[model samples]
Target chain A: MILDSIQRVLSTNELVTAFLFVGTLVWLSYLISARLTRGQVHGSAIAIALGLVLAWYGGLVTGGNRGLADISFFAGVGTLGGAMFRDFAIVATAFGADIKALKQAGFVGAVSIVIGVFVSFLIGGIVAISFGYTDPIAVTTIGAGAATYIVGPVTGTALGAGSDVIALSVAAGLTKSVLVMIGTPFIAPKIGLNNPHSALIYGGLMGTTSGVAGGLAATDPKLVPYGAMTATFYTGVGCLLAPSVLYLGVRALL
Target chain B: MVIYGVALLSFCMLTGVLVGDLLGEVMGVQSNVGGVGIAMLLLLVLSNLDSRKLKLTPITEKGIGFWSAMYIPIVVAMAARQNVFSALSGGWMAIVAGVAAVAASFALIPVLARFGKGEHQ
Candidate 1:
């Protein structure tokens, strides 16, 4: 009787339940990571890792594209994680930044974005070529993902690329960002990631806003704004350059 | 006053979307162009307008702070759900590129550090 009632409840409001399910998993992941890793890893990173694992398992079980969402009760995971909330959160980040501090990064920060984008693009393009994805759109989509996850979809959507390719681009970007998030704290001292300017340059070269933000938050909460500032600019510049100049250049090459 | 602050935040977002729409039309792209970026720029500018004139309070700033940070965890979880599954199903290229990008960036750090040539201490 109790199980039947619970099933009915889940059936009626599955999406909210999915949010609750995700929230619990994320909370649990954070707790484990904090205890096990002594906070060497960000809870967000750990939660993301757990999320991916669960998603893979969900797909393996159901043999469906939507992962856990392939199961009825968990269908809300798809909507909860969809583009609607994604854009809402992206725009929400606007109010959190300080403009004055961004200028502190100066010329080095400015130059870093250009170099970072090119280098990441080149690396991603080369990797795509090796994978036998010879199409210009495929290469460019993945290359833009190397620039930033946000840039990947924006470029892919604009260019009318395949959903699978766009998804691949997003994954590629996510992997880069997660690694940066986990690796930044360990590498900080060795790379001289102390001052606001260095933080800015770090953000520029790294070019993943959330990674830089979470990583800086762990390393030194004071530097979050500085690093995030240039990282924010990196995404904007990446978006601007990728579709036009970068795509045209890739087309020229191929 | 805090409610007014959120209202102002929404206003900034609306204006940003409009501007992004215009830019998209100009650029001949089907998608929105930099709405989030423009909104953030507006917010940065609006933050300076907190004054005795607007009757700004700590509460107003706190409200903005509260909601702004709320997005990060959700965004991370969302990305994990979307990206990982896609990368897995889309073949090994995404994973390979992701690993390669991370590796290449790490390799470039020493070079960037040398070229940057800034003081560690």
Candidate 2:
């Protein structure tokens, strides 16, 4: 009787159910990572890994378009994870940020973002070209993906690039994200990655908000705000430059 | 008191959305522009206002901190839901681009760190 009522409620309120399911999964993942990894792997990284496994499983089980959408109760995961809530979290986190530290990052911070985007685009473009995908639009869109995942799709859509190319760009960004998350803590000591100014510079250079945020949270929670500040700017700049100057320039060259 | 702080947070969030929407319109993006970034900047400004006009309580800070910490796991879950299957279907090009990009980014971390250390005093 109780199970039937619970299912009824879950069906009636899909978004809430989705949140509950995700929350439970994240909690369990955190426990496993903490216990099994002995804190060597960050819980956020573990949670993300679990999420991917579950998504792949969901796809195989349901043959649905979305990863978790095969199950009627979890279909709302798509909406919950969309830009709206994504933006909401981004905005909300801003409240705790220390703007003074962000300002202190100064000229190096700005320079890092410029160099980061340019270098990432160059690397991505080279890979795309070498992969036998030489179309200028494909190259540019994929290059923007290297800058950041958000830039990948925005640039792809703006340039009217193919779905395959856009999807590839996203994959590139995700790979970058996972790498940054896993690598940040190990490298933190070597990079002298303490303090807010350095955090901002690291954020600008990394250019993956999820990666930077997760990595910083693991290394030092206090640094999340500063890193997120410049990382956020990196995304905006990437979106602006990728679709226009970057595309036109690539088009001219190739 | 906690309720009052929650109310303050909601107000800041709403103001952020409003301003972000306007900024997006001006930029021709027709929406939140950088979405969370814009809202965060707005919140940053609002967060500062506590000293002069708002005088938000410690609980408000606690409230904001709680939400800020929530971003990572949520982002992880969201990103997994969004992108897991793409590479699966997109073929070798996607996989190769992803692997190569990661390798390249890793190689450049030291170069990026050098720039930051140059500014160190």
Candidate 3:
């Protein structure tokens, strides 16, 4: 009976590697941060490291399958990359010594995010229909990821699309990271969104939205805690609903 | 300086992903390898960060903004998958979800803040 239970446990572990992968990476990141930096390393750096390791192991364990490894590798890297760039942009704005300007930039950023979400969803929906793919999970995962450029993996997971979700998530994250890295600094100044407070608002919203998406996409109730923790720590609560809004908006049109 | 930071971070992140993928392909170690790699990198980066003077004031507000922008897409993607909008047969469901999340944050953040302050006190 004990052997049977152990077998069951091992099977369960193999079946649900997602949670394990994420959890292990996070824990490892913390351990590294604490041990190497004496706890001074930035959380973003830890996240980046965790992502890289996950991608590497994900590939090797999956048996030299590039496609298989790509999902986790991309998701982890894209997420860390996005966060890092966003943080850098905000830090730059904060160093500019202009509170009023920052506030304006923040408001503009908030508005732009709202618009970006809407537009991305529209495009994603069209892609789903055009491809003749009706797998709700795939459609939603790919569509959402392609549109908003974040939280695609979580949505993919919730939809039961497996590693593909991670792949889509990575794709979306890359898009957003690239855009924000290139666009925010140049546009914020013109639009007066360069103040530190504004950067805070923008960053908070982004973090919150990612958290909410992750929570909604979670299949296991246990993941909810991790999702919430990620949401709260990585993103602000304000952006949590962004995923749902975009999803439904597109679904409605369809 | 910010651009440089962004570039460096991006490069490190990209390198981490590529290395993780390569290692996984060669050894079949899986995502666990990526996790391990990240742990190693964090240890190295942290060691470097520890020697620098850490300042929270100017970066705090900016940090908040940066996180907010980055997170927006993530939430939007989640909502899209929830099909809450599809089940409800309207866009209002999405709006409701979004509002609820925001409301929950407002309710929860202050409590968290208080708890954090209490710890210090």
Reference-based TM-score of each model = 0.75, 0.82, 0.33
Rank the candidate models, highest lDDT first.
2, 1, 3
For candidate 2 chain A, which ten residues in a row score worst on lDDT? A82-91
Sorted by TM-score, highest first, which candidate order results?
A: 2, 1, 3
lDDT winner: 2
Q: Distance from true position, residue A18, model 3, in Å?
A: 30
Error of 2 at A122 (Å): 1.0
Clashing pairs in 2: none
**What proportion of true contacts does candidate 1 retain?**
0.39
lDDT by residue (B24-77, candidate 1, tens digit) is: 678666546656556666777777766767654777766566546655555444
Q: Pick the candidate with the highest TM-score.
A: 2
The TM-score that candidate 2 achieves is 0.82
* Candidate 3 Cα misplacement greater than 4 A, ranges: A1-96, A147-150, A175-239, B1-121
Worst 10-residue lDDT window, candidate 1 chain A = A83-92
Q: Is the docking of candidate 1 incorrect, acceptable, medium or high quality?
A: acceptable
User: Which of candidates 1 and 2 is the stronger one according to lDDT?
Assistant: 2
DockQ of 2: 0.47
- Poorly placed runs, candidate 1 (over 4 Å): A11-19, A62-71, A75-98, A106-110, A131-142, A148-199, A206-244, A247-254, B106-121
Clashing pairs in 1: none
Interface RMSD of each: 4.2, 3.3, 16.2
Ranking by DockQ: 2, 1, 3
DockQ of each: 0.42, 0.47, 0.03
Give the residue spans of candidate 2 off by over 4 A: A1-4, A63-66, A178-194, A217-219, B11-35, B50-53
